[model samples]
Target: MEPVVLAAGTALVAAMASDAWEAARGALVDLWRKGKPEEAEAVGNELQRARTVALESRRTVDPDAEQALIGFWRMRLDHLLRERPDLARELRGVLEDDLVPTLGAGERDRATTLLGRAEAHDHARIYQAGRDQHIHGG
Candidate 1:
């Protein structure tokens, strides 16, 4: 996934759990309105539904559900980016100036980490801070 698209998608999902969801959602809808006016209403409705799902997951402490929602939005944003390549910068701006700032400290930090890791290759081996060594032959 493109980094900006991943960041924007993650930020969008995180924003759904924030107090500023309405403002964030409005900006998202407006962006879509400018790029593809016909899909604006549908996007708005989907955002609302996503918000409901996000809130429910948060309330229930269902990380899996929230992650699923994130994946759903990631795919949606990926499609949108494919259709309107020029919107990448705009989406990044929304993440930096709007969505991220709206999150609480913990969520903001986590969202940042999520954004950073969004570009990670699935097949690549990852080694964390702790000292550990492994040899693998596949």
Candidate 2:
């Protein structure tokens, strides 16, 4: 391979790896907020390793597919990340402006259900965390 091509490939791989790490961290934080700290940490570690492998194979990996998968995970995180009312409102705005128009009746129903669950879980997790912190004085 040409040196210039190899350098570009390395740069692309680094970007991919960074994106993957961010996605994995978001996922782990989501899980931690949902009351599964151990599982979240495990998955986060695994994802970090996956990102390393993907970066090492950047020449062959499809960046588009990786992006699509990242989008999926990000959507999951957005739905579940309701700890901040401001963030939730912002996400809802995006959903209304972007996702709502694209969704049909069945899809809307599913989306609503999923959002409800995520919000409920987020609320509960926050409450528990606060309670724990109060009790522990930390």
Candidate 3:
């Protein structure tokens, strides 16, 4: 659930900076329409507002602002999923079928990809994970 919501939210924000924003917006609104027609209209409007801010963030090269927008949409998606757990598949559709392909090569990279770099010259250690990870040693 968390991964789907995270991917959808990331794709939502990424679409805002893409040339196919309108199409991506349509796909999102359509997804909402399936679960709740009334809320679909509101979602469309909200996407437009977010698009404005997202575009500004891109123009200024503000990663923080971009992350904020992603967080904003993630919350909304989380609530929707909580309300309708069955919508998970549809959410993935909106993410993979619509938003992802529209994104540029850089943005299309799966957000779950994690990279870590460590250099240990002596007796040293490093740890990294794409998600929940725990290390216990002495």
Candidate 4:
């Protein structure tokens, strides 16, 4: 998954739990409307339903449920981007201008961590940790 897409999807879900949700939702729907006109309304409705579910999970203190919602949106956005590569730039704009800024520091941190990854190639060892790590090897 593209890091920006992952970040944006997580941020969008987090934004659903924020006061700026309408704006974030609008931006998303607009993206769909522009890229996939036939699916705009359906996408808009899905966004609303997902937002409701996300909010409910947060209200009930269900972190896992909320994370699941994020994953759902991530897959949806990933598909959308794959189908309409042109929308990737617009998605990035929404993330930078709307979704991310609207989130709190903790939510922002969580969104950032959603894209975490570490890769190693041939003869290249990897020491990976979310926060801190030490590696000892030949």
Best by TM-score: 4
Instruction: Please give the range of 10 consecutive residues that has the lowest summed lDDT in model 2.
Output: 1-10
lDDT of each: 0.83, 0.43, 0.85, 0.86
Q: Which residue pairs in candidate 2 collide?
A: none
lDDT of 2 by residue, 1-138 (tens): 222222222222233344334642453445445544546666565556656656655557676755544444454444445343344543444344434334455544534443332245543543433123454555
> What are the TM-scores, per candidate, against the unseen true structure?
0.79, 0.32, 0.79, 0.80
lDDT of each residue in 23-86, candidate 1, tens digit only: 9999989888978999999999999999999999989999999889888888988888889999
Q: After superposition, how far is residue 110 of candidate 3 from its true place, in Å?
A: 4.2
TM-score of 3: 0.79
lDDT of 4 by residue, 88-112 (tens): 8888888878888899999888777
Each prediction's RMSD to truth: 6.9, 18.3, 8.1, 5.1
lDDT of 1: 0.83
Question: Which is the better candidate, 2 or 4, if ranked by lDDT?
Answer: 4
Q: Give per-residue lDDT, candidate 2, residue 82.
A: 38
Global local distance difference test of model 4: 0.86
lDDT over C-alpha atoms for residue 113 of model 1 = 62
